[model samples]
Target: MKRPTLSKKIDQLIYRNHKSATTNVIGCLVLHAIRSEIFERFQRAYVGMANKESSELGNLPTSPMAERARTCETTGERLRNRELAYGFDLDYKNDPPTLVPCTWSKNYAIGLYGRIGLQCYNLQNGTNLKFKRLEKHSTKRTGRYSSVYITLDATDPATGSVCSFQTQFSNAGSHLRLRARITWLTFAARIKQIPNEPIDDDWDEDTPGINEFYKVPLPKWFSDERGSKKYYVPESELHDNDWLQLLMEVAFFSKANRRLDAYLPLELNSVVVETLEDEPRDKLKADNAIFYISYKCCADPCSTPLAGDHRAVVRKTMDGKPGHMCLEVAFTKEQNKNEEE
Candidate 1:
C-alpha cells in the first residue's frame, strides 16, 4: 500500500477543524512543509545506507543495514510525533503537551518552528497556564510597542520537574502578545530532586572558626543527615565532586503584531567611536547600522569566560536598502587576563 503524504494528513486535520474555524490553516500548512522536508532528508539517508554492501566479501552486511533501518524508523516515528504535537486536531484537548525531538544538525530551528507551532495552538485553544504582562517599551516612535512578561510556571514531563519561566518580547506589537505559555497540566506537576553531593569542613580546635584550617568537603549524596562525615556505600565508591543532573522545563514567549523599525538618517556619516585591540574591527564596522535589536541570555550563561573566546557575527541590512546601516551582534566570552598572567 502507498504511504500517506504529510500534506494529505494536514488536509484531513484541517477538514476536521472546519467547523471551529479557529484553526490557522496557513500555519498548519507551513508546519507540514517543514515536516515533509525533514522526512525526505531522513528517507534519503536510509535508502542510501540500505543499498550499500560490505567491502571485503561478496555478501552485504545484514546486521549494520538492519540497525540503520531501525534508526531510520525511530527517526520517522519521532517526526510523526512532532507533526502530531504541532498538528491541529479535535482530539488535542484530551492529549498531553509534548516536546518535539530536535535534530542535532537543526538545533537552532527549534526556536522558530516550535514557536510557530505553539502560537498556533495557543490561538486556537486557550491554555490553562497563566502569565502576567510586566511592561511594554518602544524605541522607535512610529514603530510598535514591545511588551515584556514573565511566565508563572513550567513543567517538564521527562523528569516531572517544574520551574518558573521568563522571556522578553522581541515580537510584541501594539495589540498582540506572541509569548508562549506553559500548559496547565505541566504546571501542576511536582518537581523531582536531583542527586548532589554535600560539603564538609574539618577544622582544628585551636583555630578561629573564621580562619581555621579546614579539610575538603564530601559529596552530598555521600553525606548523612547529621552533616559530620561521608556516608559509606558498600557496593560502589562515590566521589565528592560529581556533578548532579536536574531537569527543568522552560518556555519562550514571542509577541506579535509589532514591528520595530530603525532608520538612520542617510546624511549622517558613520564614524568609529572607539576601537579596541584584538577585536574584529572589520566585522564591527559592518554592523554599526541602526536597527531593532533583541537580546537573550547567552547559552551556558553560568559558564566562566576564557581567553581567546570567539563569537559569530549576525548582520542584516535594513530592508535591503542602499546606504542603509546593518546591525551586527556577536557572542563572546570575557576573559580575565590578570588571573591567567
Candidate 2:
C-alpha cells in the first residue's frame, strides 16, 4: 500500500513521536500558522508550552515519544474543554459586516463661462453681464427655497475693470450667451472616508427619496434580513487584509453612480460635497446658462436622457416666507428641443 500523506501520518501520530526518530513537517507547519495569528486564540494559549513545540529548544523531555505524548495530551485537553480562544465578539463566519459613515470636502467655485455674459435684464442700459447663484432645495415642497448670492464680475470690455450696479430684478436668469463657442469639459469629484455610526439593521431601500438618489445595486452577498432597515453581509465575505478590495466593492455597489470615485466608511459626518469645478458639473450645472436642471441618474453610460429623472423647471416662491428662497425658471421650447437633440 502507498504511504499515507505527511498530514495524515501526522494526524495518526497525534503529535506523539513514533518509536523511530522522525521529523513532523506537517505538525510544524500547523504550529507556524497558529503562531502567525491564523486562528483566533490557539496560539496564545498553547504556544511555547513545554513539550508542545516541535523543536528540541522548546524544553522538550529527553524521550521523544514522551514529549509527543505530552504535547498531544495538553492540546487535546484544551480542545475538549472548549477553551479555544475567541478574539472576536461575534462569529467570524456569521456576523454582518459593518459599514461606518464618513465625510468628504472639496474647495468648490461657481462661475459663468469665460467671455460670456447675459443680457442685463434690469439695467437701464443693456450691458452684457453674468450671474451665479447657490441654490438649496427643501425636502418638503412648502414652495420655499434659499440661495447664497455673490457679486458678479460685470464690467464693460472697453473699461477693462469690473463694475457693480444695483437692480431690483433677479440676476439668476436663464440664457447666458457666449461670445465664443464653448467645448465640453469633464471634471471629477474627490471622495474621502470618515467615521460615522454603523447600521446593524437593514437599511430602508424602499424609502421614497433614496430611490431617486442611489443608483447602484447592492452586492450579491448582501442580505436584506427579512425586510429589515439595513443591508447585512458576512464579516468574512471579503478576505481579511484585502482592504482595497473591500473599498472597491463598496464603491462599485454604491448608488452614487460613477460620480462617486471613492468611499471611506470610517469617517465622522458621512458628508458628500461636490464642487462646481468637479466632474458632475456637466450634469448639475447650467449649459451656457440655458439648460434644464438635471436630477439623480443611473450608472449606465448608454442610458438615454429620457431614462433620467428630469427636473427641467425651477420656480421661485412668491409667498412671504423668511426661511426659504423660492425662485423659478420656466422650461422654454428651445430648451426642450435642445434637450431632445
In candidate 1, which residue ranges exceed 4 Å CA deviation? 1-75, 79-268, 281-341
TM-score of each prediction: 0.15, 0.17
Q: Please name the candidate that would achieve the greatest TM-score relative to the true structure.
A: 2
lDDT by residue for model 2 (1-341), tens: 99897446555555454333347666656655654563446444544443434456555444555465566778886554342112111122225422211112221222221111122221212343333221211011111211111223345555565543111111232322311111111110101112211212112335442222122211122233423222122334323312213222222222222233323232111111112222223321211112122233333446433233323222112111111111223433444355458
RMSD of every candidate to native, in Å, equals: 28.6, 25.8
Task: Give each model's whole-structure lDDT.
Answer: 0.27, 0.28
What TM-score would you give candidate 2 relative to the actual structure?
0.17
Backbone clashes under 3 angstroms, per model? 10, 27
lDDT of 1 by residue, 1-341 (tens): 99888668766776665646656777667766777787899878766656453333346446677557657778997666543312111122234633322222222222222222222222223332222211111111113422211122344445665553322223212111111111111101111112211211111224332111111111112112432222122222112111000000111111111111211111111111111112223322221221111223223434422112122212222221221211122211121122235
